[model samples]
Target: MSKRLRSILTPIIAVLLGIIVGTIIMLVSGYNPVDAYTALWNGAFGDVYYTGEVIRQVTPYILAGLAVAFAFRVGLFNIGVEGQFIVGWLAAVWVGVAFDLPKVIHLPLAIIAAMVAGGLWAFIPGLLKARFRVHEVIVTIMMNYTALHTVNYIIRTKLNQGSAKTGMIHESASLRSPWLQELTTHSTMHWGIMIAIACCFIMWFLLEKTTRGFELRAVGFNQDAAHYAGMSVNKNIILSMVISGAFAGIAGAMEGLGTFGYMAVQGGFTGVGFNGIAVALLGGNTALGVFFSALLFGSLKIGALSMPLEAGVPKELVDIIIALIVFFVASSYIIRVVLDRFSKKGVK
Candidate 1:
């Protein structure tokens, strides 16, 4: 089969397999799979409010997926996207609360703060990987805890109002659109979706249409060969991590500015950053693939809320299905080999 066909079929088959396995689990657990699935669909798309919520959930997933995919494209593992995301969220919220400029200027400034904070957070690990030969995974993982505690302290000391969260941001810095809320029947959807979509196009253009992207991909394929070809492998590695962190930061900004309009101290990881790894894998690390995969993930997440309410199925079942899909995607080489054998037989 052609590469394009394989790319498309792999994810489709994985999703089907996930659903099949999920159905079996539901049956064994004494629940009707059909009813659960029907409820899932209705919850995700039954009304304008649910659809808007799905889009709101998808907005951050797209950016976080891009963060993971961008790093993967450069052969880097940036596990600290969670940390960078937290810092970026805090930075954006700080700027949003502190500033009182016009909407146009204030919003951009808040976003830029988020990007810079995220990029700088990732830069430390990238620099260590490039200059000291330290493994980025360990450094980034450690940094995640550091970021969490540091941000928590900052919130308590500086931004807190006898609560765990900071004060609400100014209206100019808010991404909420009253008209959109009205259209969606008061769903939390915001203009951040536009920014996420723009980032998708930007990622596609950069990775598919630019010389810099070619260099990054070359380094990912084989660092020695890229270096032999006169590319600065170290530079590209650092640049890739920075860019990845920036994407993750923007994802966090979506939550801070658009969804919550403030920052809060969290006890643990938000899961969005970690989920991006699965999203990138399922998306085949392509921009367009990321967009669709994010939608699927978003739908599963938002729709899961109705599983218990509508069908007496536990919401955790949806998490299981998501995990199964990722597992199938990860084991796709087995599927590819099977497909190749069938193709060979047909050709004969």
Candidate 2:
């Protein structure tokens, strides 16, 4: 199969196998598997409102998925995407509420602040890895906690504009579109989705069309080899982290500006950042793949909440199904075994 064909088929097959396994689990648990899936489908795409909600959920995933996928291409395991995302949100919102400007300028400026914050958040760990030869995984993982506490401190302080959250962003700076709001009284879905789609194309262009991307990929496959081949291994690694963090920053901007319109004290780590890991994997760490996978996940999430009302199942059941799918995808040995057995039967 062509690489593109395989890239599309692999995830589809994995999802089917995951569904089969989930069915078995549900049957064992005394639930009707067919009913469960039916509920999921009806809940997610049953109506226009539900469908819009799915779009809302997927918007952030696109950016977060790109964040992880970009880092993966550079051979860096970034475990602090959650941290970078939060810092981005905090920074963007700070800019959004702290100043007043023209519509075109204010919104874009806030978004830029978010990107800068996210890049700086990731830079510290990148520096630690490059300068001290520290393991990037360990360094990035620790940085997640640092981001969590640092943001929490800022939120509790007056930095949040004398409230749990800053005042509502200026109407001029808002990304709210009247067209989408007509469906749901209010939803977070906004122009961020357009930006995310554009970014996906940008990522594809960078990876396929740019020399810097080639150097980054070279470093990822083999740093020592890349070093010998005239590539600056350290610089590439640092650049990779910068790009990765900037993607996460855009994710923060989507949530704070598009959805919330203000900075609020984050009660906890939003799972979206961690969820980026799975999206990256399922998408094959590619730009186009991440876009579709993000939509899939967004649908699954929107459906998860509706399943309870439609099927009398807990929302967590959907999480369990997703977890199983991710687990099976990670352990391809199972799929290999299944495919091997089917081949043997054909030979017989």
Candidate 3:
């Protein structure tokens, strides 16, 4: 099988296997798999409201997935996306609440603040990795804790008067659209989806049609070779993390300005950044692939809520299915070997 065929088939087969395993688990747990799946389907796309919610969920997933995939392309493991996302959300909310400018200026300024915060948050680990050969994964993981506590402290001491969250952002700084809400029957959808889609195209163009992208890819493929070719490996590494963090920042902006319109103190990780790793993996780490994979993940997340409400199935079952899918995708070498054997036999 060709590489392209293998790439396409692997995720499809993984998804099928996940569904099969989920069915068996549901049966063992005394639930009707058919009813459960039907409910899941309905919750995702049965009405305009649900569809809009799915799209809204997908918007952040797409940006977060791109963040991870971009780092992967540069051979960097950016475990700090969660931290970056939180800081970005906080920064955007700060700007949104503090400014009283016109809609165009306020909105763009808030969004830029988000991107800058996220980028700067990631830059610390990137700088360490590039300048001191520090392990980025460890640093980023630690940074996640720092970001969590720091944001909580800021919220308690600075932003919130008595509540656990800052005030709602100004209307001019918000991403919500009244027309879009009416069109989607009041789903929490926003213009962030358009930004996500535009980022997808930008990612594709940058990675596939630019000299800088070639350098980044080259550095990722072989640092020694890239150095020999006069490419600045350190620069690319820093640039990659910065760009990846920017994507993740926009994801946070979607949650802050578009979905929630406020920044809240969190007791734990939001899981969106972590889920982006699975999205990137399932997408084969490509821009277009990330877009579609995010949709699938988003659908599962939104639909999971209906499983229990409609079919008496546990919502956690959906988590199991998602875990299985990721497992199968990660273990795709086994599938590839099996396909190769079949191809060899057919050739004979």
TM of each candidate vs. truth: 0.99, 0.93, 0.98
Q: How do the residues 83-155 of candidate 1 rate in per-residue lDDT, one tens digit apiece?
A: 9889999999999999899999999999999999999999999999989989999999999999999999999
Compose the digit string of candidate 2's lDDT tens values, residues 1-348. 244555566677787777788788888877777777788888788877777677778888999999999999989999889999999988888887878899899999988998999998888878887778888889878888888888888878767667776778776667779887777545556778888898899889998799998998998899999999999888888888989999999899888888888777777789889999989888989999899889888888888786677776677877887887788678755666666676578789
Which pairs, if any, clash in model 2? none
The candidate, 1 or 2, that scores higher on TM-score is 1
Worst 10 residues of 1 by lDDT: 335-344
Local error of candidate 1 at residue 345 (angstroms): 1.9
Candidate 3 C-alpha error for residue 334, in Å: 0.8
| Deviation of model 1 at 172, angstroms | 0.2
Q: Candidate 1: TM-score?
A: 0.99
Q: Model 1 clash pairs?
A: none
Off by over 4 Å in 3: none
Give one digit per residue, the lDDT tens place, for model 3 in 48-162: 9999999999999999999999999999989888888899999999999988999989999999999999999999999999999999999999999999999999999999957
For model 3, what is the alpha-carbon lDDT of residue 100? Answer: 93
Deviation from native of the Cα of residue 134 in model 1, angstroms: 1.3
